[model samples]
Target: MSRLFPFHGGLKTVRHKTESNQQAIRPAPVPRRLVVPLRQHIGAIAKPLVQPGDRVLKGQMIGQAEGYISAAVHAPTSGVVTALDQRPVPHPSGLADWCVTVESDGEERWVERKPVDYHRLHPSELRNLLRNAGVVGLGGAAFPSAVKLNLSGHCDRLETLILNGAECEPWITCDDRLMRERAAGIVAGLHIIAHLLEPREVLIGIEDDKPEAIAAMTAACAGTGYQVRVVPTRYPSGSVKQLVKLLTGRETPVDGLPVDVGVQCFNVATAHTIHRAVDYGEPVISRVVTVTGQVRQPGNVEALLGTPFVELVELCGGYQDGVERLIMGGPMMGFALHGDEVPVTKATNCILAASAEQLTPDRPVMPCIRCGACVDVCPANLLPQQLYWHARAKEFDKAQDYHLFSCIECGCCSYVCPSRIPLVQYYRYAKNEIWAQEKEKQKAELARQRHQARLERLEREKQEREAKLRQKAPPRSEPAVAKPTLETAVARAKTSPAPTLETTAETVNRDG
Candidate 1:
């Protein structure tokens, strides 16, 4: 069994995590206002269902999923819709996106709820419930879980299930703390997933450095069919692809999902949320977030989604002055927000409010020297240098040919780059451009089809009109009775009513 689940490539990263794991998880105070971005996940942005001046209760669906892959957004607290406009989001570019700004009424009230016996329900029903509850991958990918679990009909074989509890990223301990404190919930969630997939076996992988988490998870799995496997602590061990390789001994093919190798991996936190959502009639209203780095009180907080970063910082005893950057998630893959005003969303697992000492300043970017460090650290084994060169030259097609989609944008290239170049940014730009171009192509194709259909209809109408005119014409057998000579025609006209000008004109006009 162990042979089937061998570990894979990873890196040793600095873990400045003294603040979070040292203490028990605590709930952060709710802020007076919350700014919830419509797009918190990796799919189509949810459309707002509420307008300004409307009131919303906690766990109320405020945004509807826009497309098949999108997830709905719930109101994090009982609040009034103060505004629905653009606001700064926690992004690498520090840009703004459409958001819902709500002023809290201090009533963390609950709406009506009902739990579904997920075990008794069909797989589709379970997936729909998960979708309605707004469950998504909590480890930062934010991919909708329903879309993932609905893959059973597409496959025939079941091999392994990997529960990723390896919180290997520095300064992020939300998953670690959850595994330690809520292992039962995690296990319960895993059971739900197991029921859906019904794989041959289950493996829960945790980093060895987190002994408490390991022990708790192991205790939870004692009599169950699940197996808790402790892996060496390494950066990116928690990544979906890497963890899949570590637990299944099967490498996911490029541009493929874990299911390609008859496997599935879910974040421990994501599993626990599934348990709560399906079994307890609870929606994903709040989540455990790690608030640390250069703050007076650095620790974990169970924060409501859409809680402002500033409020969280204040709860963590505020910054000690000279804070350089506010990062969402971890330093390795996390993005720096332009300001502390952005609110926490379902995807926000950690907020690292770092000072200069905590986070190094952005150095001037230099040219890549082909040292291959980026290639070495890349877990996906993609050619980062080649992709970087293509991106720099705006050769997007060449980049795609090199499997740009397989890059994973894990920030490994940027992290190990000697040039300090923002490789991930370039990759993102390329990806967006590609998507935009594909959309344009689709639009152009549809327009061409419409135009051709219209042209065909016009041609058919013209032909039909000509055919009807031909059918209505007198037959050739009805030719004029006599071919009159010029003198006979003139004598007939002269004798007919003395050939008045008006009469001759009317007769000729009528005959012609």
Candidate 2:
């Protein structure tokens, strides 16, 4: 065992996780309808496979992966496609996105299933299978798992594989419950990851708060030689970069990934899904989600993908009186969802029906007190005040200079701010501005390239036409000019010799 490395700064926030983790995970009843978003994952949106009125079976792929970084979408249950149009999705912006609405028939018929013999299959084939099965990072990023497994140009062999069981975000107990109940399945998935990456060591990093999870995972890993390293309970400890640094002493390069540091990470629930997809031929149709905070019965539920958040709230005995906001994910890093109508996607881990007290109370912004509390609690060791200044002033370049992207939007700075500044929101604005500017720059560059290519093509065509004309033109033989001597003139000049200049001009014009 190696010594654990410490991250720069973190907080000891409230752990509202116990309430949700106390109950056994229950299966959420299949909803009558599912609104499946095609662009749930963080890459190219999956192309729709079925049309309206088409009958789909449970586990059938409703959408196919369109690009390497995209994940396929499966039918959560047998149903008929009702609509393939824009609908309000669970996003911070309250925007509508493309979704497939399926009305379930209550039959729950499944498509044929064939489990893979992964040991005998080629690595590429295995990856494609996982893609079709629609595996993604269940830890909110929703990045396709196949892309991480490929590890192209990142490393030769992985040094470590860290499993993130540190559900540090308050009120999110899905992973915690998953670890305690399905430790064996999780370890089985770890074996699959080990076989794929062939890492030298496998480490599972769980927060010290989850003793039961740690013990269960420990017993499960006894014969496998994998380690269960209990990390100190801290806010944002579940973050991939922070966890990697804590467990392996390697800081992932800014703008890079864990793989760049010779390491890779996957959420524990993600690993369990991999095990199920390969061993049981099950696609990612359902996932465990935490339904807590201001609900009548707070706990975890294994809900099918596309199950409406409203239904989950109902399953938990409906919302309590005076519930103010509904947030997806946890309160710390999560975003406030517009309504409960949004359907669960791969990224849906927790649904927080927050009361006004449980939610971060809106406060009037005062001038920065310059108390430096944000600096002390920042997990990324960044200057929150400087970032706030630049972002507030719209000086995005300055914010970038201060390493704005390094800030993980952990809400620590905002949490500690005396003036109640929403620092994370400002940082998000700056990053979005930068990304938009970059995208415009790319579009302009592409247009320039196209124009340059057109100009070069025109020049080449002009040269080719000139060469063809030169080939067609007759070779000059000095125009057979006879000497002006008397005998030569009498013999050669019998007929009126055409004007050499005129004839040449005519020939050139004709060729032209």
Candidate 3:
């Protein structure tokens, strides 16, 4: 309804939707083997409840949630556990993490399940049910839904819950197809959310280009309180902040979430997963994925969690030719995989087998010509050049002040950069550094607490000794000298500043 172009910086990159969107979503034939990762969901890495040589049925819990913010992992199909160890996953480093290898049985048997009448249950009961079902944000974030639903009573006057259907990524058609085909199920899930938040307005934001999805969703909400809002087709329109502004004209503050602006957004695919979890009592064991790019037959496939990319590619007729790169998700936000051995986790929305032409063209480094193209397209309104300068200089704290975390690493800045700088990589490096620092800070805080507690114990003992001495004899008239406090004793014992154990260890370890 309002002007769509409120932001200054955005890219008009090539849209490669024609490759997969033309065909209706086809079920990806079951693979003979599925490599299930234990830590598919966010928060804690799940601990395997089943070991090698154990038989597991489809939808059965194989890995238990590790901690409060984790989700359980279910068997994608009836299979026997073949292996459980570190294996390559879909990450930028192509690094290996803990995973479970399953040898599938062709029968596709499902475990026993009982759906709950969610309407009659309390909010906490519903939240617990969703948590046990292993539901998480289906968007690339992969955040646990239960934790988000149970936010600290900071959310007041919560008005709207937005369903993001704007699969803005060029090659990812999973969400788009899901909405078009399963609109009713998604709407039913919306009702579930409505019950939880009791928001008067529920806006389903889909890109204008997705006419079929919009029409289907509109019809699906015919008698319901939900409202379908078709937004302009724009890159990064599906981003939480961008979509919020587009739908509600509210600009969220820096370092704040959608809840800060009286809104909560969930991916449309996530809604469908909620429907399946609440209605059928099924966990998030599998999801729809768009496997496209240099593959022979590019299309959408409902893939089991922890499926190997190679297996998905094979189902799609394999690569045609000149498959120079294998990326997970779209070219803009996806990470390039070293091989197809990486498993499809809950976070993976697509597996892109890109050729030289489809992927970013490899070019020599160029100098910035003060083009200001990058700044013109940044969704976060951050100065890309300033971030790059600080990051390259290793000024991490300064980068944080510039809202480096806000950079979604959508590749828009790098996409339009005349100099072709790897801007996102720098931001990633800075973010990782910040996280590492935060961990160190937390450890230091814990150590301080322990030291304080020990000091308190020692002081209590000294006080008890003095009290016993006084009780045994007449109290001295002279004022007792103030016993040296912990700080005083430590100061008297050391000539110089006392080095922390960590610092001393690092110094010794480095020299050694």
Candidate 4:
């Protein structure tokens, strides 16, 4: 029996996962138009490669990774650039961001594909290739996969590499289905990651609810020396820290990452993408998304990134009558998006078209009565009530003092809140405000540094000019010496008359 490291607190919420997992995965039809966002993944937003009116082939690089931390963006279809402008994207704030609009040509044309033996190339080269391929964490964190592959910065030796297959979120069944259907691909991807990290042990954590996925993945890992461990069905177990703790019993520090504990994690989908990128030379053009909840027929779709949510909903037989909300993920952690026009990005795992009669009915938010319900259910073992108080009062620093960043925003607190305080929303607002303030401070500091540099440069230039003038200046001429001539003698005698006058005055006084 695998020794289980149980986490502090979690809920066994209603798992509405069967509705979507019952059907096999299908490819979402390429829409007529694609609104690809530039800043899909975490870190810097990708730099656009094509302007309006430019032609692009599917899988061709359209947006270059801004830096080492960013992932590249690609064209999902062969199309003409209709517009490069800001459009509404899938953000909690429902804000508009820069998007590359492409009008599809229906050709589905692909760029040249070149598979590489990653072992033959330098590790840095392989990472760069993944960056160009636009591979990132597909389990919704959307962190650049290539950046995580390197373990040298984290520790001297990696003891474990975990592949998170625990699709613990209630409505999100994308990872579960991926494991069941594409187990070999996921395992192959894990092998590639092992080559990069060379971890001592590899483990894939899946929840007990995914029996099919667990069996499929276990059989797939038969010869790979990787273990597929089924964890208890618990909400938020799929999260990085919790999953790591479940599998390895290691607690990532207060403000640290998984790597700090001699462990690293990758989403199973991310591993599959890495495999495809290295083995078949495929860029991350599409992903499997779960379209579940109150639709006529719900299922998972291998959707091209930038496919409209409306098209995806229609693919699932449109929203059922009396649909109240359209959420982007599970009802527990997901945010309710305003419209379906928001294109899917790497982070989109599930699109829940919720009906009025479904789970988590709209409840009136009331004042907190100092209840400890949120604290008991917090998986991170944080004091949710204190964090909520500080956040609601705009004491962001105090919230941080209570380890607010460690909260994971899992909504467990709000779920158990008797008063329906919307605790998670308050935490998110505090986090955003803190981030904005930090960004402003950074900008101000950068500007101050630049201005100081400019002043120093001007002063240096002025000093250099003065030094050059002194070097180029002519030497002063020596004072002309008076020749002992009549003119000089006369001038001297006139000037010396006062000395003779003193003697003459003395003689005149004697004569008187």
TM-score of each: 0.87, 0.89, 0.86, 0.88
- Candidate 4 structure quality by residue, lDDT tens digits, 278-359: 9999999899999988888899999999999999999999988888989987888888897889999999999998887765
Query: In candidate 4, how many Å is residue 416 off?
Result: 0.6
Model 4 C-alpha lDDT versus the unseen true structure: 0.89
Order of all candidates by TM-score, from best down to worst? Answer: 2, 4, 1, 3
What are the per-residue Cα lDDT tens digits for candidate 1 across 133-210?
Answer: 889999988999888886655567668888988888899999989988999999999989999988899999888888
Tens-digit per-residue lDDT, 1-512, candidate 2: 56899898899999998778899999999899999999889999999999999999999999999967899999999989999999988889989998999999999999999998889988889889999999999999899999999976999889999999998999999998999999999999988888899899999999999999999999999989899999988999999999999999999887898999899999999999999999999999999999999999999999999899999999999999999999999898999988899999999999999898886677788899889999999888899999999999999999999999999999999988889889999999999999999999999999999999999997986687566655543322223453345665555446545445555575478567
Q: Is candidate 2 or 4 superior in lDDT?
A: 2
As a TM-score, model 4 comes out at 0.88
* RMSD in Å for model 1: 5.6
TM-score of model 1 vs. true structure: 0.87
RMSD of each: 5.6, 4.8, 9.5, 10.4
Total backbone clashes of candidate 1, pairs 3 or more residues apart or in separate chains? 0
Q: Quantify all predictions' global Cα lDDT against the true fold.
A: 0.84, 0.91, 0.83, 0.89
Give each model's clash number: 0, 0, 3, 0
Top candidate on lDDT is 2
